[model samples]
Target: MKFSCVAAVALASAACGSGDGAHADPDLGVESSDTGALLAHADPEASGSCQLPDGPRTVHQMKGPLEDLQGDCVPTWTQEELNAGFTRIRDERMITLPENPGFERRIPWLAADNGCEERAQAASYYLTNWDYTTPYYARVLVKPNKRLILKTDNEPGGSVRWTHHVAPVVRVDGRLMILDPAVEPEKPLPIEEWLPRFSVAGEVDVALCRDHAIGDGCFAAAPVAPSPPQIGDKAAGLHLRLTAEWGVQEILGRDPHRVLGDCPPWVECEAEPTPDENRPPTIRHFRTDRLESEVFFPIYVIGDNFVEGVTTVRVTGNGVDEIALIDSSTMRSILLASWYDPGEYQVTAANGAHVSQPVVMKISEF
Candidate 1:
């Protein structure tokens, strides 16, 4: 019921804990002293202490609360210990596409473009399970029209932008150090250095949520939630509570390798590096579903090198042939399945003069 919301301007340091014994009262609407704003509507479903059982977790359950509120429950660990823990988690980054044959263990780094929330939640579970320390999350919520641009080698153009970002935080040598491997792969970054990376000319609101649910609570507690006009969408909020097991399994409920889609809001399912437009479109995967109405159902084709209006999709075979260009992204495209007869068909994507190799799709009679 207790969390800290710090309104930060130009990355100035702000205290991150409640000392006044303030707790959110559903009826009266508790106002966070830090933000001086009434607490956002609490999720009626959120209840009980935000703590979990000690040791490794597997089942999904409400986490129990931490008992160390005297110091805001942030761990006081040595620099060496902090760095070691950071490295241990950082090493979990996947070196290749998660689908690659040899891909191994923790953290989907390749899905880094817009999966910050999932990544952070997964990290928190690991930190707790490894016996490193139970950690709090540092959430940076940006204002309208601003972006948290992070330079990275993971995506094309050597950078990625975010509406907001959340990472696990630990107190090292009295300083709040961030454990975001996606941003600073080598070491922990102080909050000062970490905050400014989002925007140098703009101000952002920061909050320290005790758990995943509280992170969403922080966003709800904010004054104005920004929607980037340029992106034509709102950033997804974080809702990761690591009281169960290893972060990935807890969030995914299965092996990371077996899961498909469930992508973070920043990117769509089967998103990959933008392919060279000069080349033929590549079809990485395709997904289809049945709808009740079945009028103009969509066929989602995930791939690379797709031109918005110019690229075309062709599905042929089994007494039906269809081709159309509906909507497209560099990594994803939507083609109208239009209640095609149930049968196997060969599908190919084309951009300009180049065409992709044929892939198979089985459409069902709706």
Candidate 2:
């Protein structure tokens, strides 16, 4: 089922690439090329949309050993239990919700039959039903396969729309913290109130944010910038450099200890070169006219060191036919580039026309 307005707004903000032995083979397994097909067949009625497919509703459920249990499954709670349970966890221990003045105060409810106890229960139902969990500090970990839906009222200037997005949460003080890419890309939601509204299906672990350091659990697993390149001996008449950057943390918390090997004594820290930096000697040109009329920019990354991905080129004004990726070193255009080292890159059409951003090839080197 789809998320309510609150959850939709919450998730929209939290929000990656590579190259060839160039082995241009794509990791089609992780790639959601078929997601479009699955979405096409998805039940819209489940999300309160008229265009939904007719089928058994796919309720979001947690996987793993703790899937069936609820809230640690304690039979009895003493004073200590009451103190330690989510009820006593200070607001400071979780991520805060965003305040959007533009957001409509009243939202349509799909499952009014299951009226939530409060906003927190509403939020919980959205998350838990979708197999998403918001632990203590509004820190949420979304499974890659999950899709969030948001259906708008069909009125003038209102059309039912859906988007796939993600957001990460952090906790500070007695409030919830959020790092949402859609609302505040760089800035974080340092403080906000979390109202529990939904009944969770399984054992949802809500920890006190005070238990962990700020920005420790959530974004820490995200990809980090690689170190600066080290000058190595030149070879084959081409400059050979060795650079080290950090990749995505293994997310051991998501997997079982037996499956993922023993948890590291301390979080593992390793570095390697990024994909774009490892481009082959030959240069090629790749261009797309998808965002022909809009002002768009190409985002590329070298390592975590840079702020915005390298803005190779910017298309200004309107009606621009194509954008190309060229080699700065050789002044040659790269028609088809491969990406092996996974990172985030995009060509955004600010004007919003044809928003088709296809995955380029991925290449790896020995």
Candidate maximizing lDDT: 1
Collision count for each candidate, in order:
7, 59
RMSD of each: 15.0, 22.3
Question: Which candidate achieves the best TM-score against the true structure?
Answer: 1
| True lDDT of residue 319, candidate 2 | 32
For model 2 the TM-score comes to 0.18
lDDT per residue (tens digit) for residues 1-366 in model 1? 223222111101111111112223211122333342123322212233323224222112212112112223444566887888887776643322223436443454444455455566556555554555445667665655666677664443367676666777767665778888767766789877877665554445565554431223332223221111111112222211111112222122222333322332222466445456578887765544211212224566656667666678888898878785464343344545355567787888887779999987766665
Candidate 1 local lDDT, residue 224: 22
For residue 181, give model 2's deviation from the true position in Å. Answer: 6.6
Instruction: Write model 2 residue lDDT over 24-99, tens digit each, in one string.
Output: 1111011123233222221122223223213211112111222221222111222332233322221111221123
In model 2, the Cα lDDT at residue 124 comes to 31
Query: How do all models score by TM-score?
Result: 0.44, 0.18
